[model samples]
Target: MARPVISCERHSLRGLLAVALALLLVCAVSAGVSAGQAGAQGLTPQQLAGQRVIYSYRGLTPPQSLLDDIRAGRAAGVIFFGENISSPEQIAGVVAQLRQAQAESPISRPLLLMTDQEGGLVRRLPGAPVPSAKQVGQSPDPVAAAFDAGLGAGRNLRGVGMNVNLAPVLDVFDTPGNFIDRTQRSFSDNPFAVAALGSAFITAQQGTGVAATAKHFPGLGTAPAGQNTDTGPVTLPADLSRLRSVDELPYPAAVFVGVKLVMLSWAIYPALDADRPAGLSPMIVDRELRGRNGFRGVTITDALEAESLNAFGTTGQRAVAAAAAGMDLILCSARDTGQGESATTALADAYAGGQLDPAAFDQAVARVDALRAGLR
Candidate 1:
């Protein structure tokens, strides 16, 4: 048998197969470890561990500690006020830094950079303000102008690294003396017209990757006389039928157009719930908007730090209560120079103390994650 000699080629082939198998085993072990790490770091723990705290930033550059907190998944989102903005370029730079910090975070979720860019008086970024919704409605081609304005606003916001514009006030201008409408924020007293133009605005906004929020839902335009819902108790007088006809018209239109965020009003609709504002009312937030209207989007509470809510409870308590009432984001509660540590600690305490249901918290986090995924 010629010394039973094995060919050099066969020996090389056998060695190659052994090396290949070793490599594959090593790769499989590495993959298993990576997957196990990911499974161990599931979102449920993070979601149930704390509340999503949104704070305002005023400095030209965000502090490194603040950025680190965001990167560590300690903060949820940031809102920029007029004090934080001097010009569009400055705003852009600040937002870029924030986004960069967010990118470096362990979690890859989108960091919500939000502003009240509704135009007119509520505009946060100056030198690029579009006319109010009312002004857009004043144009003969309201749809075209509204669309252009929305596109323009979205472009401006996106230019500065903002993903959300708290805009397109859907409140019908039924009351002439209403502060928001008096400032020309409302589109029209006519529900149909408001619906049409508001939808156009939302379409333009979302068309450019900037999510538009149809705000003060259930309609702040119907707030009782001598009351600004942001400051005091607000009562909506419209019956369900009337609400469906007027105040609720633009919301569904926006929803139909695929709006990503809806901001609940601090205003209380006596017909809907006599005790709590829309933001904290289960009947209104969970039942009316989420259930009745089929708005399967992220629902945010109006600034929890607002005076109207200050009368109800401490900022931390209000935040936990609002989350319980179906709000996904707690905005404007940051203490300590827009750091939001107090609010974050408050939420963490609530979670640990069993005041907030872990399941409910997880659901809200899932909704927020879904919204961010859609953006991606």
Candidate 2:
């Protein structure tokens, strides 16, 4: 039969109804996709393991292996050493490349480019952050000097595109001529002075958008001379009372100043936990650093390859142990690049094998993700 011509108004009405139906279908599909993503919001086993590690490479350029790790979301950040830097501009370029790699990753959070820019001999970057910690500590106005020094250091660090400064060693210079003091890393021997000056430095640095890290937690200045944890395990003999009074004195002040991270010492603190080093001890990292001090920021372990952990396990094993111990970040700063991958794999395996507590693992990843969220 011959088709009858439809009225223009009826055709237009049908067209509008068809468009509305299409729009409704589109909305339904979009909502379904979003719901699926929301269901997958929790980190996968690999990402849960990977987000906890900050790795190092051998040369100045970002290596293919490290870049690959970033692309796979297997790296948390990078730590630059004196050897990786020749000049400020060169370091800036390196940082840019690292950041570009991070940006291209599936998980595009800002990568933490950090260095030991504590000023003085310990500074990885060239030039002065102005007055070393010792110089600031001994100055006429110690607190003001420290604040200015932190500002100067923060400017330099930010100029290079680095977000974290492994600086402001808050450990009071206890064992003179020891590792920290001989290098002029500590602010002072007096806890009160350390607290005041350290707090000022932390506030100023973080104010400049570069997070400050209080290092060698629970104090490494009390360790015996020449017994550096990097070379060998050393035990601190302070009792619990002295530990709370002296070793842990500066930390509370740093925490009060909103220090973003604290690096646990590798050295065994008998008073805190005689069985394990602070970095691998739950008593120190979980109960003490997280609970007692009430620091809600990130807790990073000193180098996972440090000699102090030699008897503990291999690089991967130590990384897993540190994470299991409640540390949020596992730093693999050894010369080899493979250690970083190994650490990631080890962490993933531990969680997958049911060795790590799922709740603790989730909490650790949440803290790390929170810190990354604060990055610019």
Q: Please state the error at residue 297 of candidate 1 in Å.
A: 0.5
Q: Which pairs in model 1 have colliding backbones?
A: none
Q: Which digits, one per residue and each the tens of the lDDT, describe model 2 over residues 226-255?
A: 889989989987789878887788777677
| lDDT of all predictions | 0.70, 0.78
**Per-candidate clashes, comma-separated:** 0, 0
Worst 10 residues of 2 by lDDT: 29-38
Model 1 local distance difference test score: 0.70
The Cα error of candidate 2 at residue 38, in Å, is 12
